[model samples]
Target: MTVVAEAPTFLWLEITGRCQLACGHCYADSSPLGDHGTMSAADWRAVIDAAAELGVGMVQLIGGEPTLHPGLAGLVGHALAAGLQVEIYTNLLHVTAALWKVFTLPGVRLATSYTTRPTQPAMRRSRAGRARMPGPARTSPKRSAARYRCVSA
Candidate 1:
């Protein structure tokens, strides 16, 4: 008999532990003041390479908000370059024009966790989510490409 371990279907890369919001129901308790100082692009590159070697087809980029990571675009590009599907979850709080260009990349899936607490009025923090995040960029089997997914959590 022969045995082979099953490869993981997907993996998560937490690029940052900081966020622009302090949502009451946050699973990670992320805040504007949180810190994710040590990890670097090289570190992420290694992880992506490893997963690809193991036949993991997809990777989810998360954070307090992974968008807040300065090298986010490069990171996404690198992952796609490595032939891995990428998904990002963010409030879409502060997306810039340059970042918008990045979101148009072929394998990137952008999901907006546009949230509202019953106690507090809806906060207009996700400038990206509001203006540009209104439709699906496109869709494919390995990854569902959407510019917006109004997720509440």
Candidate 2:
């Protein structure tokens, strides 16, 4: 069989590392007291322009939680105007009614993150699923995330 390479269909943009919840397994080490992000709204719009020029058709907003970003709507608008599909990854725990309005556009989706991480062995062994944060210092975030999907789903 012949194999063909496929172009990337989507782009990931980390708008901020700020978040309301401080989970034990957070990849970005994000918390309610998170530091302000460096990029401005103009920077995001510029990036969207570049991504569209590169033929990227979709944009996935990420971070500690993208909803925490003050300029999220402008960023989403830039992507939408650039002819790209927009999706936001977020934990429903922090979404306010005002923030919810930003997601009302066509082809925009909100994926929920409800992952669990147990520090102690007992909690790790919860019937919920096997999250990788349990083992030891050597474990990786990638490994932890692989196991964390069960809760997120």
Candidate 3:
């Protein structure tokens, strides 16, 4: 007998591998010098189209930092236009104006992680300043419906 597997309802796309900080616990080994993979905007668009065609209801954009991708806004827009819910996992350290706009889109949401253990001395210093920085609370639109998920380690 053959077993059939159902199509995935949720998908994760690692849009980039570049980040501002290097955390020891990072499973992706993401760092300031991480390689931004060769996937182009067109390539990502095609993937988004294919996922939507496959009946994928949601796509989570993750990375060394997803916001570092230059075409992030366009990718999110394309996914939303294709009727796919978009979730972005980021460090909340380098969100640009364009990316902020994408976060306000109807079908979009944001997630971030914070680690109390500063494995790297540089990371410890950086976290000290970041701890005082207002994250999504200060940047998010007052009337935006986007949901935010915060994970701490």
Candidate 4:
């Protein structure tokens, strides 16, 4: 009897191990001093290509914070061009303009985690207040609308 291997429908890529924070609950033990893996842009591109060829329907880009990876935007673009849906898990802390642009692409989605610390008043704010916090919401109304559409779609 012959057996066939099924291709994976989902792929998770921990593109980097670096993060801006050392959260106590971090599963990867990721922190500011964490190791940013040696994979170069070309290497990541190849991996993305392979995943697409393997019939991966969705790819999740994760890390201590994947946004810290310099080639993230390019990687996202490559994955999308290969007809793969991309989901990025970020801390919403270090979103550069280039990354933000790719994130708004049709086949891409952004996800974030929020941990509340009662000791930190800022952390206790409602979801709406947190959404209006400084970093991620610094875009124009049109851009914000685009982001909303991308995220909500």
Best by TM-score: 3
Per-prediction TM-score, please? 0.72, 0.70, 0.74, 0.72
Q: Give the TM-score of candidate 4.
A: 0.72
Q: After superposition, how far is residue 112 of candidate 1 from its true place, in Å?
A: 2.0
What would the per-residue lDDT of candidate 2 be over residues 27-69, giving only the tens digit for each residue?
6656665654888788889989988987899989998778878
**Model 3 C-alpha lDDT per residue in residues 91-130, reported as the tens digit of each score:** 8875778678879999999988655545444442453324
Whole-model lDDT, candidate 4? 0.75
| CA lDDT, every model vs. true structure | 0.71, 0.72, 0.75, 0.75
Strongest candidate by lDDT: 3
Which scores greater on TM-score, model 1 or model 2?
1
| Tens-digit lDDT track of model 4 for 110-132 | 98877545534544254533453
Task: Locate the minimum summed-lDDT window of 10 residues in model 1.
Answer: 143-152
Q: How accurate is candidate 1 locally (lDDT)?
A: 0.71
Task: Point out where model 1 deviates above 4 Å.
Answer: 1-4, 116-153
Error of model 4, residue 129, in angstroms: 28
Off by over 4 Å in 2: 1-7, 116-153
Score residue 97 of candidate 3 by CA lDDT.
82
In Å, residue 21's CA in model 4 sits off its true spot by 0.6
